[model samples]
Target chain A: MSERVKVTIDGISVEVEQGTTILNAARLIGGEIVPPAMCYYSKLEGSGGKCRTCLVKVSKGSEKDPRPMPKLVASCRTTVMEGMEVQNITSPEVKEARKGVVELLLINHPLDCPVCDQAGECHLQDLSYEHGSAATRYEFDRRSFERRDIGDKIQLHMTRCILCYRCVYVADQITDRREHGVLGRGDAAEISTYIEKAIENDFSGNVIDVCPVGALTDRTFRFKNRVWFTKPVDAHCNCDKCSGKVTLWYKGEDVIRVTARKDEYGEVESFICNDCRFEKKKTSDWVIEGPRKISKHSVISANHYEQLAPPPVIRKNPALKEANKEQFERVIRY
Target chain B: MESLSNRKKVLEQKPMTFGEKIYLPSIAKGLAITFKHIFKKRETIFYPEQERPVSENWRGLHSLKRDEQGRERCTACGLCALACPAEAITMTAAERKKGEEGLYREEKYAAVYEINMLRCIFCGLCEEACPKEAIYLDGPFLEADYLRKDFIFGKDKLVEEPLKS
Candidate 1:
């Protein structure tokens, strides 16, 4: 086993592996203190440092050094040291910096959340709501691009790409062949397949999963229904190409779309093949598990009454119970 | 026996006088009240010919709005459908074709938007939930229909009329 190092983030201390990044260390101690990352993916190798949303204040360098870093560092790239201290949400500076970062990210990003397929579960939407300013200060016409199809299945909207390169990383590491990559530089940089080549592979569909924005989306499920309107159920099938485990998004009795199961951070649990994603569109294709547990805060769980138990905190505390009396009454009505 | 709820009144019967037994005085008093109301201001209107003015906040039948360009303003984001507590709103979204830019304000448009007036409580939740400001309860109240299917307002009934060229 690697050596262990103790690090403090947002006043909470956690012991993680020696070479672990501050973001991972904070994640080990999980909760609100963990910094928000746009480009970083745990599954994809070398997928951090591009997006500055995870910037954190390093108050203390290490036990031996005892010196604070001059500037805030990207928590996803900076390694933790023994007795190091970091501030994420606790620091007002970090909060202001994050707001600025969100603004910069939104400069070119077409605010088309209403029409975008990734509206509800989109990370950018959540980040902007939490950290972004209400209106833009930019006085220029925002860049626009004609929507293009990556293939018959995937639709690409260049206007919405934040250039996080998470999809490019997915194309590099997961797929057998890398056909699509970031082209151009600075304001002109965009993800594109060379010479309008089609990315046909077993795992090209995974790019849709990794994309933080609605830049890449499944054309089959295009404009079918909102993410919150569809019900997600965990299902699995016997397939030789890849893991058959997937989440089937049901619009009623029919399976409108199929996607790999996503974790709390919106990362796919496992990359499924194109066959499992595109071919299987019926209920009979896989063994059905129960309804996927959606977070209470998410709009997807708006009307779901399956889990009616009051939160443990409310159950334990009298004050909390008194405050949430109406919610408890609602639960009773159900 | 004592009453469970106390303060009961006892019977007090008395022999009636000639004036009380005749009942002419009581009849005259009732007629006076009826005669007084005849000259008073009218309370109701002839609704079919002269309709009452609806309040500014009155929520009636919903109408899908159009942009200044007269293009359909609804991108079919489904926020209205999600917000409809009665689940009255339903829509099928379609991508705008190459030549259809003049018809739709956005690339994605609601191809088939419907609201079951029977199911709709007309709470104006859909109006409040519309992100594009495409939906509003501004049209006249839904008229009575013979069949249940007619109550389901489709795009034809819901969408606003195109502006004159």
Candidate 2:
């Protein structure tokens, strides 16, 4: 039996397992310190340590010790110790560090949110809004790549990619068959298929969901409707490969898109197969279990069903009227 | 005083001569002028079938335009709606899905575009505000409709047909 370790996150004390990461320990306290994680997913194996947005300062050591760590450690990868003290939520230095990391990640990202399908539901977009700079200091040309079809269903836009590598990890760990991996190096590193082979995996569609940005988008749902406009309904189907609990995005009467239904903590229960994500779009294919409650930040729910106010009546300027009257008097005198 | 005397002089009528008193020559002269028009080209046109030539700058009924590639030029940015003085234009934007590149010029397309013809003063402000060159006021005059609902021009009537390649 593992012993529970007491960890303090932003003054909130949470007792978690001995090997629990500092990120998970903070999450146990509920909203006390939500370190912005782009590359860390709990379900996927070997998922943390990338995307250094979750750095936290350990002010105090475990119960047996009193000394603190010399440097800030990545909370997503660092396991918690008993009586450890972490500063994530109320730290000025951590916030500034996160801002710098987010800025660097956005240096090569293209400004194509208006056309990107993932704009409303993107992790990078949300993180940037919370901790990113509006203006970039990098004045040089941004990297651009030709959009390619990775498989029959997935379209990859490399320009908007932040290289979080979540999709690569998901494909390797979740799916039974892996067809693609990250290729090249440093600034030119990209997710690519072997010898330009089209990804024909059954769970190929999950890569789009794993992508934090618009780098990987569904070809079927591409440019169809924004995520905020479509209402998400929890649904299920009896598929052989996996449990078909998914979210169907309904726009009017038609099912415009489909995605994995995330839990209250915004984590997908399981990676949905390609058939459920792309093939099964009909409303009758799955049983509907009411509408998913949209978050306050959702662009669709905010803009959807909004009755536009009629344009305000434009009143004629009094100065123009006076000028016209003067001109009329002058004409009469002439 | 001078202006009043001038007004009185202008009101005074000159006496007619013996030939003019009969009014036959004057009446004949008027009749001759009227008769001259009978032999000249007719000014009035036949209704329904014939149409008068409209001026080049005439702002008539609105029609949407198509690009050279036959794709719709409108991205549904709503600039025209903001610029409309009459508030006749209303539209909703939707993303242009995959395989719809041939239909829309951009990723954002107008899903529901309607213009209330009754409210539209044909001021051509919408045309001027259109950044896509998608809308213009060059179509034929709006035909009379029996119902009020028919006056509301939807995308079905406004969007131009794709130019055949």
Q: lDDT of each prediction vs. the true structure?
A: 0.91, 0.81
Spell out the clash pairs found in candidate 2. A223-B97, A228-A300
Q: After superposing candidate 1, which stretches have Cα over 4 Å from the reference?
A: A175-177, A309-334, B1-18
What interface RMSD, in Å and to 1 decimal, does model 2 have?
Answer: 5.2
lDDT of 1 by residue, A235-279 (tens): 999999888999999988989989999887788999999999998
Predicted complexes: DockQ each = 0.64, 0.12
TM-scores of chain A across candidates: 0.92, 0.88
**lDDT tens readout by residue for model 2, A1-334:** 9998889888888899999999888777766376878888887788878789899989998878868888888999999998999898688988899999999989999876656788778888888999998888999999998888887788989888887777888778754666678899999898887876877777778878778788999988876765765688888999888789899999789998898977544568898888888989898899987667676555545544332222233125666556566554544443
True contacts kept of 2: 0.21
Using lDDT as the measure, the top candidate is 1
Which tens-of-lDDT digit does each residue in B27-111 have in candidate 2?
Answer: 9999999999999999899867998889999988888777888888877666577677777887777877789998888768888
Q: Best DockQ goes to which candidate?
A: 1
